[model samples]
Each structure stands twice: as structure tokens, then as C-alpha cells.
Target chain A: TQLLEQSPQFLSIQEGENLTVYCNSSSVFSSLQWYRQEPGEGPVLLVTVVTGGEVKKLKRLTFQFGDARKDSSLHITAAQTGDTGLYLCAGARSGNTPLVFGKGTRLSVIA
Target chain B: EPEVTQTPSHQVTQMGQEVILRCVPISNHLYFYWYRQILGQKVEFLVSFYNNEISEKSEIFDDQFSVERPDGSNFTLKIRSTKLEDSAMYFCASRRGFGLVMNTEAFFGQGTRLTVV
Candidate 1:
């Protein structure tokens, strides 16, 4: 079974502060995706990193895939209150497999 | 923007009662999935449906759980007999045919909050 472990299960920071959440795994993935979920809502796709060592940016958020495709990271620059949410990392094994999701990092950016 | 839609945003049912959760995946998506997240927990995959049949399922998806794509767009999950522990927020997701690209990202619905009493 493939598992993605997320670090710093919870994080709270003042608005404008920077933070990074990490997702690690022992198995390789074909692609990795980051998602942000607000209370009472489903997760929204933030970005997807397909190539190893690739970086993708979405506004203030930066996502990176590991060189080995076994891990990924999400870095927030100058985070705003709106950036506060449950951040999840999901890895897709292949075309026929369902994505395996991380436990998620609960981020709170206080204004 | 295309989006996955789930009905009965919230449901409350008595134990032992059967319940069916409904979802309408994005029109052009071919892969459909059902997931559940307990309060304060991570999203867990329940089942994946393709070509009008189930392609994969998790251990959590036991005999009590069943999925069907009755039509071209609607995907449904049925829980034969609900238990107190069955309560959770259920989400429906869809993806345009899978591949190793950004387009493979699955779109999710707001979710249905199920509370089994």
C-alpha cells in the first residue's frame, strides 16, 4: 500500500508569513497534485506536478515534485488569510489506480 | 468551469436504513470516484468507476457499499445498511481520462455530510 505522510499536522502563522508543507512517501508516483479545502467544502485542485524536480506556481503558492517522484512540497509565500485551509497532497500511481492522499496540513493564516 | 455536483448536501438517517448518495460528474470526465472524510480526518478513497463498472475499491469499501453509473453522467453510491460509524462527509470526484499530465487532476464536489443516527 502506498501512503503519503504529511508533516506539521497543524500550522498557524500571521498573515504575510511564509510556510512550507511537506508530503513524503516510499513509493513512486506518476503524478502529484496539491489541493486546498475550506470548511464544509470539497478539496479544490491547486496544482499538479508531473515531472520529477518540477516546480509549478499558482499565485502565492509554489509546489515541487521530488526528483524521485516519491515526495512533494507546497510552499506558500506571503500567505494571506484566504490561504488558510486544509492542504492535501495526492499521488496518482497510474491510469487505473485511485489517488492516494496525505493526511493533510491544516494551515491557519491569521490576519 | 466544469464541476462535479453532489445532491442532498446533508443527510441524516437512522441506523440500519439504506441510503443512496448521488453525484453528477463533469460532463466530459470519464473517470469517477467516491471518497469519504470523517470530521477532522483525511479524504479516503472508497471506489472508482469507469466504463460503467467499478475498476477499484478500498478496503473501507466493503460488501455494504456499492456503486453504479446508471447513466452517462450520474454516478451513485449506495450503503446497504448504515451504522453509526458510517457518518462522514462524502465527496464525488471526476477526471478526464487518466494520464501523466496536469489534466489528470480530479475535480471534486462540495460533498454530502451524512450523519447516521
Candidate 2:
């Protein structure tokens, strides 16, 4: 079974602080995606990194895929209050199967 | 932008009662999928349907769970008998079509909050 392990299950910081959440796995993936979910809502796509060592940026968030395609990281710069949410990393294996999500990192930014 | 939609945003049912969750994927999407996330837990894969039939399913999709794309737009998931453990936020997702890049980004719905009493 493939599993994605997320770190720092909970994080709280003052506004303007930077943070990074990591998702690691032992198995390789065809592609990896990052999502941010607000309370009582579904996850919204943040970015998808398909190539190894690839980097994608969305506003203040930066996502990086490992060279091995077995890990990923999400970095937030100058995080604002609106950045507070559950951040999840998902991977596609093969076929039409749904994505496998990480345990997720819960973030809280105080204004 | 088009997004996936699910019915009965929230449902509360008694244990052992059968329930059917509904979803309407993006009109042009051909690959449909079901996933659930328990309160404070990771999102999990349930099943995947394509070409009017199930293409793949996860171990979590047991005998109690079934999926069908009755028509071109609607995809439904039925649970024969609900258990307390079944309580979770169920999400529906769809992709343009399975291809080299189609699986890169699968759009997800707001999700249905199911509470089994």
C-alpha cells in the first residue's frame, strides 16, 4: 500500500511568518498535487507537480516535488490570515483510482 | 469555472439504514471518483467509475458500497447498510478523461457531510 506521511500536524504562527509542510512516501507517484481546504468545504486544488524536482508557484505558496517523485513540500511565504487551512498532498498512482492524500497539515495564521 | 456538485450537502441517517449519495460531475469529465474524509482524518479513496462502469475501487469500498453512473452526468454511490464508522464527508471528483495529463488534476466537489446515528 502507498502512504503519504505529512509532518507537523498542527502549526500556528503570526502574520508574515513563513512555514513549510512536508509529505513523504516510500513509493513513486506519477504526479503529485497540493490542496488547501477550509472548514466545512472540499479541498481546492493548489498546484500539481508532475516532473521530478519541479517547482510550481501560486501567489504566495510554493510547491516542490522531490527528484525521486516520492515526496513533496509546500512552502508559504509571508502567510496571511487567509492562508490558514488544512493543507493536503495527494498522489496519483495508476488507472482511474482516486488520489491518495496525506494526513494533512493544519495551519493557523494570526493577524 | 465548472465544478463538481453533490446533493443533500448533509445527511443524517440511523444505523443499518441504506443511503444513496449523489453527485453531478463537470459536464465534460469522463472519469468519476468517490472519496471520503472522516473528521480530523485523511481523505480516502472509495471508488472510480468510467465508461458507465466501475474502473477501479479501493479496499475501503467493500460489499456495502456500490457505484453507478446511471446517466451521462449523474454518478451515485449507495451504501447497503450504514455503520457509525461510515460517518464522514464524502466528496465526488471528475477528470476531463484519463490520459497522460488528465489525471494530473482531478476536480473535487464541496462534499456531502454524512452523519450516521
Evaluated with TM-score, which candidate comes out highest? Answer: 1
User: Which pairs clash in model 1?
Assistant: none
Q: Model 1: what is its DockQ?
A: 0.85
Per residue, candidate 1 scores C-alpha lDDT tens digits across A22-80 of 99999999988899899999999888888999999888888999999999999999999
Cα displacement (Å) at residue B38, model 1 = 0.9
| Best-matching candidate per lDDT | 1
On DockQ, the leading prediction is 1
Chain B vs. true chain B: TM-score per candidate? 0.96, 0.95
Q: Where does model 1 exceed 4 Å of error?
A: none
For model 2, the stretches where C-alpha displacement exceeds 4 angstroms are B100-103
Each candidate's interface RMSD, rounded to one decimal? 1.0, 1.5
Model 2 whole-model lDDT (C-alpha atoms)? 0.90
lDDT of each: 0.92, 0.90
Error of 2 at B84 (Å): 1.5
Error of 2 at A95 (Å): 5.8
lDDT of 2 at A89: 93
Worst 10 residues of 1 chain B by lDDT: B96-105
